[model samples]
Target chain A: MTGVVSPMAAPAALRGAGAWKPAELLFWTLPVIGWFAFPENLPLLTQIAITALFALSLDLVLGVAGMVTLGHAAFFGVGAYAAGMLPAYLGIGDPLLGLVAAAAAAALAGALTSPLMLRGSGLSQLMVSVGINAMLYEAANKATEVTGGVDGLPGVENTPLFGMWSFDLYGRTAYVYAVVVLLLLFWMARRVVRSPFGVSLRGIRLNAARMPALGVPVNRRLAVVWTLAAAYAGVAGALLTQTTQFVSINVLGFDRSAEVLLILILGGAGHLYGALVGAVAYMSIHHLLADIDPEFWQFWIGLIFIVVVLFARDGALGAAARIRDLIRNLILGRGASR
Target chain B: MTILFDGIASGMLLFLISSGLSVTLGLMGIINLAHGAFAMLGGYVCVVALDRYGIPFPVAVLMATLSAAAAGVALERLVYRRLYGAGQLDQVLFSIGLIFVSMALARWLFGPQPQPIRLPGWLQGQVQLPWIEIGVYRAFLIVLGLVVAVTLHRAVGVTRFGARLRAAVDRPAVARGLGIDVDRVFVVAFAIGSALAGLGGAVGVELLGLDPSFPLRYLVYFLIVVVVGGSGSFEGSLVASVLIGIFDVAGKYYVPQVGSFIIYTVMVVMLIVRPQGLFGRPSP
Candidate 1:
């Protein structure tokens, strides 16, 4: 326990303080702002926004809670199916109610799984979660009469948000709706992470045994955190279904789960912004590479992963930090820093 | 009856491939998920050797195993070395990365389609068992797995090298202090693990065939066997694998609806009930 110093107790070194320049803002944010301002690009912006939120939800578990799950797509799938099937199967024509159902269903499933999952270490936790997802996937595939098998469920006509805004195919409504949801979730996540409970989670993640010794119910805390993360994932899934109006079996696939994990890793887990950066970078690369050569794209992706792991320990953020350091040192001559 | 025999053969092959993973994981506390990928690569290589160069089946398998072993050694030096004591998450991330790299390389070299290897003419045809006729190749596989298992059991359970390896595992730092070459031990263990994976891949392809997703799809089965058998217990892996194999076979053949998926759930239950596995030592 002597060398087991929690990251919380580490000195606040101001690692990225004042590093974001105005030009950098112009370089990144302006394009995004411009794209969103255009009517044609709304759908694309909305998709990115939703995906960013989903990645953020996964970050709550992998990043903040220090729980790595290989089966989070199960929760995502749960939400998607809830939103999709409620209308299609149960004849709940109202999309708003359907979305709430999706979130609530996923939250329920998460609550059920959290206790079993929260007790294990990373490997066992990964295995159990993965097992649960695989079982769910199998069930989803087999329950063809109910789930539509491999063909997927369709015909989801989403009502307008608050009955005032119709979701236009041009993606205007979806984009704004997604943006609002993303902002709200982002703000809530920020508040949650900054709370005392979040502090306790950090403490448990750093050293679980010590927390129990310090009177914290480590397992119970983990269960609650996992459930919250699952609820977030469920929301993302519901949004995906709502926007697409089609729910496929691939939502709960291992590749989806693995990709989410890769995004979190690439984005640098532990930072809220990491999930956003990771989703954007990963999806953009995937889009770019698929356009180049669908067959050979994985090769390039694999190479990038290798390079990221070998060089960028902190991933893309580390690269950004390095560039910032270089610019700062160049401006104030190396000899000027005392 | 024939179904039972076929299932047995398949289970034996899986056990052969997974045993290496179990041993290395037990001793080194390293979770090498890339083990299956290596096996898949071996299967692909053997397929190419037989199909492309018109090489003999036995020769192709030998070449594949040797090449896979070499790859294993290289992996140990390059990637596995960095993962020691780095936590399970790091091992998983790094190994998963390696799996992707291996998969990418396999796809690049062999393409994505399943490589159907033609068994040597001698190994073809069915064998007349007491109750039923079985595929001659499958029967041969079962015998081979048993021989390997027995030989390994003797090597690890009876030999001085096994004793030394156990000693090393038990007190790695002290073993180093006592002048044992710990690095060499690690390298050898990894090589042995990869070799087992290669061996498993070589045999399994005869029945299951070669595919890109082979490694990932069967990863849970392998990990479950290792965990249930208790890490570091070769005999336990054998016992656990056999039990799982029989259960899987019976489940698929008889009760396909319930048992196939429940295997993993059973594993979870077992872990909850006996965290150290049925026969493993309690956590220190």
Candidate 2:
């Protein structure tokens, strides 16, 4: 807790707390470049985007609000199921409409469960979250008629984007759709974290007891942010459902919860871009590792987790920043001598 | 009557496995999510010794317990010692990572299939009683569990080491000031806990089954035992484990439809209603 880099400490001039930085603008162009550079890997690219969004949702709660959870996948699964079921049960197949429905369903789930989170901290919080996730998973598993049980829900159909561009075999449309949604949500997340309300959330995270005396409604803020994060995760899950046109029990599994948390931490939590960077890095590594030995990829991921936690506490982004700072200092020293 | 008997036997097994977790989690304040993995290690050790090495059942079990305890000491010294002051998040991440690594390692060493375990002739078949007939193995479990429960109760409650452990748990700094080797106490307690888990895993193989996925499969059960019992309280865990074991068996037998849903729901409600657990002292 003491050594964690504050999310608010991002350079205002270079990273820009509220405004879009030039570097960020440059970062956004990579997807466009990827679209042209690697046409065959559109599906993988789309997965990275969706996962990034999921990691971003985690960052909102774990990194920004300081509510450590192992059950965030509950919201993701709720959203996925809601989206997948909409077309099956309600006959509403529009992608945008499904996203909206998914977000609302996840947000509702978050709001209902948020009170449980308010009960305690550390180990108790972890247990509560795990319990909630397990309960949902079991419920989903038993409701075979609806969820299709372990075999997964089939025939999950989604309408073409804006009723125009249909999801293609190569996942071209899905890629564009996923990237666009990720950008919009990432922008919204940035605004939310930069607002005065966001600052209070950070204050609560740093010192909950002191925040109450500062007139900050700690519990309410936690609830709101959690709900918002759930909505984001729901949207990401819906994207997966819409793009892949499938929903499985694995969506809500403990593995997903743990994987997303690892991805966020790997990218460097607290910072928005860390989610994006981590999703890309983790997914790429997973892709490579799975190709070699699908069964043992988790071994390497676990090893990476250990190494990162012990050596690189701030994650990839933090390490990159330190390197950049060192280079800048070297350049300044050279210029003064000249 | 059968359900109660079966439940109590299984509950005894749960107590053996989770008692160690209770001490480490409650006393050391470490959320060791990978505790089940150590139990799995013990189970594997027993299976390999019995099946491959032609070791007797009792000898195999002893080897399992000792090996797991040795592994625990090595890990604590090398990895866990560094994290004594880290945040719970770091601990969670590290332990989860450990789980993944161990699971993969187990899978590689033993195929994904459940390892075959053969009980000795003496431990086989059922024994008839006045009101009920119980499996010889289950009866053995109940007897072994009682022995452990009573022994542990005395060890923690009556021993000088137990006094030191309580002092360290209550006030680490003060305990150190009073010339107690807090670190050594923790290491010994941790090793003892791992040994119990190993013993539990080796013995419970018949009831719980054994596979590479053993750790994740039984993770929730062990956690429930510790949490419901109250983290650091030994007596509390014993009571909670039995309650849960009965509740789980009864839920499966009677409801048949709800499965473990009832157990998880109870745990959630317990956590919400009483975060300190049934017997745990409320945090300052």
Winner by TM-score: 2
Best by lDDT: 2
Each model's iRMS: 2.3, 1.0
Q: Model 1 residue A63 lDDT? A: 83
Q: What is the lDDT of residue A275 in candidate 2?
A: 83
**lDDT tens digits by residue: candidate 1, B79-139:** 6777786666666766777777677777777778888878888899987877899898888
How far residue B164's Cα lies from its native spot in candidate 1, in Å, is 3.7
The true-versus-predicted C-alpha distance at residue B181 of model 1, in Å, is 1.1
For candidate 2, the per-residue lDDT at B132 reads 91
Off by over 4 Å in 2: A1-16, A314-338
TM-score of chain B for predicted candidate 1: 0.94
lDDT tens per residue, model 2, A210-329? 988877779988989999999999999999999999999999998899889888877667777778888988898899999998989889988877766676664324453343334323
Point out the worst 10-residue segment of candidate 1 chain B by lDDT: B255-264
**Each candidate: chain B TM-score:** 0.94, 0.97
Report chain A TM-scores, every model: 0.83, 0.89
